[model samples]
Target chain A: MNAYPSKLVERAVEQLSTLPGIGRKTALRLALHLLSRPKLDTHTFAHALTEMRDGIIYCRQCHNISDTELCSICASPSRDTSTICVVQHVGDVLAIENTGQYRGVYHVLGGVISPIDGIGPEELLIDELIERVRSGTVKEVILALGTTMEGDTTNFFLYRRLQDFSIKVSVIARGIAIGDEIEYTDEVTLGRSILTRTDFDQSIRF
Target chain B: MNAYPSKLVERAVEQLSTLPGIGRKTALRLALHLLSRPKLDTHTFAHALTEMRDGIIYCRQCHNISDTELCSICASPSRDTSTICVVQHVGDVLAIENTGQYRGVYHVLGGVISPIDGIGPEELLIDELIERVRSGTVKEVILALGTTMEGDTTNFFLYRRLQDFSIKVSVIARGIAIGDEIEYTDEVTLGRSILTRTDFDQSIRF
Candidate 1:
């Protein structure tokens, strides 16, 4: 039989190895590290993980994670409520926020449409988003999902749903990213960059 | 102010990032992955970590992790208790066990002697080990610690202490590993391999 110093240590390693990107060796190291620390520190770590999982609430309006009913972005009066930036996950929301380029609230779809994964439109917050747009307060819906096939499928689906609302629907621009060398850029991105080249004045503003 | 969608998420990410090799980005991904799983899975994970920390016991004889007063190795009657393999941590014991090369028991020092880290002989299980050797049943003590300065210091200290007990002391062999080519091998290891070259028959047995 395989030997572990203790069943408790083995159980902790097993649980930690279940995390993404962590293997058994890494899990053993992390488990030992936790064991070496002050007992109070490990207690705090466990408490934080459990409490975050159990108590975190999703924003009612936009389905973003929030401590309260409305997320900070949705609660702020300064953000443009008329424009909603649509994203696939909370991480994307943070990435967009880091850019400091947009001052609009966001609607998180939880995930994009992936039929192979059995994730359909009904599994997402599409109905809530449609209702928000129908309320007449929203004037524009910006699609900022990924560029994968699933992302494209989700964008097309959302566009079809919002067609009769008389609200403007737009997609985030995609091409060679800023500071990327043109020679090293992927063929599809370089072709799209030329086909959808922005005016000189607009490019200079960015 | 630094922005996080929720204070709970920020706290979880902070706690997770405290683990070795887990950066903020990876911690955030892990936290989100846990949140996406069933609430029961996360609860189980947290419970395992906390329970392991608060309830795990250390074997009185060898200071290895244990569910009882004596670790399984220490309690077993079939194992060769007369030959103790001393290591720096519980993980080291597991690693050696996985090799299936040794049948002797283990003594975990918890850490090596390092003046830079303020860890001295008193901080480790050196005194307990000396007492174990003084019991006279132990015939040999193998030092299986790392090759670092701290490991050497600790090994020297233990060797000096065991001198008075009449127990045979040995260290695990150190040289270029079997799979490593001489061209890519480091200078110190190559020199050591030549200086401590084993007899052909002895090497063939391994």
Candidate 2:
């Protein structure tokens, strides 16, 4: 009268349900759809998933996804090393890169500081960034992180840490809404907006 | 400027996009979410996808998904062998299986006969089913395929073919709306609804 769906279907259902917005019914539907596919297609799909897990490594320099020791931006000699853009995540790095205007390198903080989530300065890559700045290779630090409360907290922490440094610290400007996801924005507007960003402290001249 | 997203991200994105409703944005969001997760969690997630794809195979007897040559229903000697339920896809099998009443085996036709899509009887596994029936191991065939135009067309074709056999032929109730997906219906309604199915004849069935 009762049995769990086969172990494979159960596993597949559980995994698919973990994705954002997918429910048990949707997961079952998706699993059934996938099962109908030819074995090779499913195998290839699985292989891709497995390879994705094994292949991507976080860049040692900026924390962006990379195949090698550094991400593309960190490896590129043509990029402006004097200007480093700090962002909340690798996705943010991609969002800024999609503009094709920012020739400077980047630093991904892994995530914003959120007390609610128990994330703080020690949990982020702020110490590595401070060391990078202190190494005398950077002139400007573009704070392109989100404008959320957590983003503000991370930004303030960096501001205090870099108080004695000679680098110019600026945040990306306000064409973006406070609660919006940056990845969905158009490249041109975001580029124009980033280019026109104001300094964090107006009293301190560069 | 034209470089693809890293191979790992691209692979995950491609696989995710192949799902029914996922798009590139959603795929990327999911990929980044998985990327940000701990290594073991990501590995387990990826492994589940791959294992489901590779380990699961169609049951030779019922065409339902299974890890073995025959599905659980087909292997169970306790189930009725005289009545074989025919469905358009495996998902229909799950929908029917959700109802505890049906104790018969199943036959999956892969898809309906869609003239517009150039799908015909030869394209489906109908011939194999005819052979299975002719072997005298079956007495009745209940058509659980949907009520779409293609489904009707396929049913008509199958009905004509099965007319030669002495076995009784019936259809699941037309209580389902034409073009309605069976997966959306609840178990109790679907179960009680199937008990009252009208006999099919092109002229008087509707």
Give TM-score, chain B, model 2.
Answer: 0.79
Model 2 pairs in collision: none
Q: Model 2 TM-score?
A: 0.77
- What lDDT score goes with residue A136 in model 1? 79
Q: Whole-model Cα lDDT per candidate?
A: 0.92, 0.81
Each model's DockQ? 0.71, 0.37
What lDDT tens digits, residue by residue, belong to model 1 across residues B1-206? 15988999999999999999999989999999998899899999999999999989999998888999998989998889999999999888889989998999889998999999899889998888888888779999999999998898889998988899778999999999889999999999899889988899998896
Chain A TM-score relative to the true structure, per candidate: 0.96, 0.80
Per-residue lDDT of candidate 2, residues A1-206 (tens digit)? 13434788888788878877889788888887777777777777766766777788878888778877777778888999899999988778778888787999889898889989999899999999998999888999999888777888888889999888987998776576557678988786588668877676962663
lDDT of candidate 1 over A69-165, digit per residue (tens): 9999999989999999999998889889988999999999999999999999999999999999998789999999999999999999999999989
Provide the lDDT at B115 for model 1: 90
